[model samples]
Target: MAISFYKYQGTGNDFVMVDNRKLAFPASDESFIKRLCDRRIGIGADGLILLQDHADYDFEMVYFNADGRLGSMCGNGARCTVRFARALGVIEDVACFLAADGEHQASVERDLIQLKMNEVKGVEQIGEDYFLNTGSPHYIRFVDDVENLDVYEEGRAIRYNDRFKAEGTNVNFVQRLSDSEVFVRTYERGVEDETLSCGTGVTAAALVAGMLGMQSPIKVKTLGGNLEVAFEQVDEGFKSIYLIGPAKQVFTGSVSL
Candidate 1:
């Protein structure tokens, strides 16, 4: 069957989107979904997203990793879905939806998207790295120079290490460039390699640094582009955390799967 799909990217993290409002698409076949995300012979993407109907929100975002397993909330994927929703008239300029993590809010203004991520409690410092879940689980560590570091080598060690072996976590290497600016490199688990960008990874990285005494409105530079995370910190947790960057439509087409 030919599946109508739309491709979109938030920074460099790309996704193949399908409007599955009728829920007619097969959601149970892992191999089928996995093959659809294959770069060599399929409509390549970091993930696949289904825009389904929601009872109380604009729409529902169902995310599947490249491995064909349903995953926790994906920030870049969410932004792409929001933009897709707007293009489909599910929303006009603003939208809210329920993800695996919980409720999320986003707005589209002039092609750029500002997504409000879930509140992060804080980062737990274990040894040298900080652990936190910003919609998705991430391990944030600061290094001297992030650009030169071997992200795939070092990140794989920490991700596959015995401590996080059951379900590996995404790893991020961050280097603070200034009080409010930092460079980030990530080793994503689903893609299982270093992509040009990662939204949840950056969100976790910024929150971890902010909790550790860095300032808010943090600027994060990724291989794809720059993203800004702004928030207010309180004794309870980090609130009003906003992930802002460009979420653009790459192309739209139908693929036979």
Candidate 2:
């Protein structure tokens, strides 16, 4: 069988995208998906995304890490999926879709995408770091020299630590650049290494930084590119959270399986 796929990247976090609305792709074939995301021999992406039919929303986003396991709500992946949906004519400028984290809303203009994230009830402060779930678990720590930090070594330590070993977690090493900007590096759990960028990780980083007195619409710089996070803090929790970035199609091809 020859499966047609599209490649997309948001802030350097790339994905192999499939329009599976007709349910043609085999969702249970873990090895096949893993091979497609393998950097050495396959499509070479950080993850894979499926745009499927949804009864209540514009579409359903099924995401998988490079390891072939179902992953949590991937911020960048979702943004890419939304753009994919738009290219497929499933949506116009604004859209609402279903993901592993639940329903999410998004808007696309040109190559830029703005996604509405879930509300965060609280942020846990562990030692000097902060732990939060912005549709995905993230461990955030502020550092001084982010440019030279060993993200893989340091992030792996906390990601696989006994405290978070059960489910594991994405790790972010951040350095404050200004009141509204910061530099972030991430080690994603499912990817199991340092990635060029991480959407959920940055969202958590920005939120934690905001809680620490940074302003809304925080700008985050990553190795891949830059992203912005904006939110409104309510009395009970945080709301109107948005993750903004660029998601562009890299290429498209057919792979024989």
Name the regions of candidate 1 deviating beyond 4 angstroms: none
Q: By TM-score, how accurate is candidate 1?
A: 0.97
Across 1-257, the per-residue lDDT of candidate 1 in tens digits comes to 87798888888998989999988778888887888888897888988999999899989999999989998888889988988999999999999898999899999988678999988886778899888889888999999999899999999998999988788899999999999899999998877888888999999998888887899899999998889999899897888999988888888898765
Instruction: List candidate 2 stretches off by more than 4 Å.
Output: none
- True lDDT of residue 40, candidate 2: 93
Model 1: worst 10 consecutive residues (lDDT sum): 248-257
TM-score of each candidate structure, all chains considered together: 0.97, 0.98
Compare the candidates by TM-score and give the number of the best one.
2
